[model samples]
Target: MATLHHSSFCPHSRFVRLIMAEMGMEPHLVEERPWERREEFLMMNPAGTTPVLVEEGGLAVPGASIIAEYLDETRGLGLSGLRLLPESPAARVEVRRLLDWFLQKFDQEVTGYLVTEKIHKRFMTSQHGGGPPDMNAIRAARSNVRYHLKYIGYLISRRNWLAGSQLTYADLAAAAHLSCVDYLGDVPWDEDEMARNWYARVKSRPSFRSLLTDRVAGMAPADHYADLDF
Candidate 1:
């Protein structure tokens, strides 16, 4: 069996988890804090990032995009479940585009700021630069999320999923980031009905069940974190 090293509130880590579940790959889960920079974990991924997948054979795969592509290559796309990367080249390009959009753009503007301020800060010591959450950063992240939610609504209104008609990594990527923010009750779900409806569909998936139940050591999820109807 493979082992997945991940953080509870890391959106990228969560994205990889969702993909693994969707593909029916049951890897042993090891919750990690990348900030700690453990030597053993660093040996596996020199970059010291979470969501590293170490195969039973001792091959380690780092980063969400690499792992997702590696799984698609080794497991054979569309074999066990939905094809995360679309078959057609054009379609695949679109999927990758949206995947980057959420993982990079949205993350920098919203998820990254919020998580670092709200969750990571609590876990860090003053020696490591950890302290009280920055109210300004949190406020900016909150304002940024509303625009993202609206953008999601616009995308889903035209297509069944973010990238296209078929569910793909794009959806998983977006959902993963949104799930992290939603856990903190930062998402304005009520502001965009289309986006909320789209999320409701994604939230009900079997792959999403584990995330709903995920609880950080000292932080509680939002009241509706696990509610399918919400």
Candidate 2:
């Protein structure tokens, strides 16, 4: 079995987790806080990031993009579950584009700011220079998320999934970030019914069960986090 080192609220980590579940591969999970800068963890990933996947044979895959591609290349055999990446060159490019959109653009504009202020700051010690959450940053993130929700609604209105007719890495990537924000009660789901309806379908999947049940040590998810209907 492989071991996945990840943080509970890291959107990139969550992306990899969702992909693994959707692929029907269950790797052992090792909860890690990259800010702690553990020596052994650093040896595995010099980037000091969550979600370094280490295989039983000692092969280590760092970064969400690398891991997703690695899995798709190695385990994506035959007609099993939906392939995270599409077979056609053009479709694959679109999936990667949307994957980057959420991982980089959405993270930069919304999820990253919110999680850093709300979750990461809470875990940092005073010695590590931790302080109160930045209200201004939180407010900015909140405002930005509405635009993202609208974007999600717009995409789903035209296509079955974010990238196209198939459920690809694009959908998983978007959901991963949205799930983290939703956990903080920051997502304005009611403001966009289409986005909410699409999310409701993703939430009901067996692959999403583990994430929906994830509980941080001192923080509880919003009341509707695990509610399939909501």
**Candidate 1 stretches greater than 4 Å from native:** 78-81
Clashing pairs in 1: none
* Alpha carbon lDDT of each predicted model: 0.91, 0.90
**Could you give candidate 1's per-residue lDDT for residues 1-230 as a string of tens digits?**
99999998899999999999988889899989888889999999999988899999999999999998998898745564578887889998999988899989999999999999998888998877699999999999999999999999999999999999988889999999999999999999899999999999999999999899888778888998999999
Segments of candidate 2 deviating more than 4 angstroms: 79-81
State every prediction's TM-score relative to the real structure. Answer: 0.97, 0.96
Worst 10 residues of 1 by lDDT: 74-83
List of clashing residue pairs for candidate 2: none
Superposition TM-score, candidate 2 onto the true structure: 0.96
The count of backbone overlaps in candidate 2 is 0
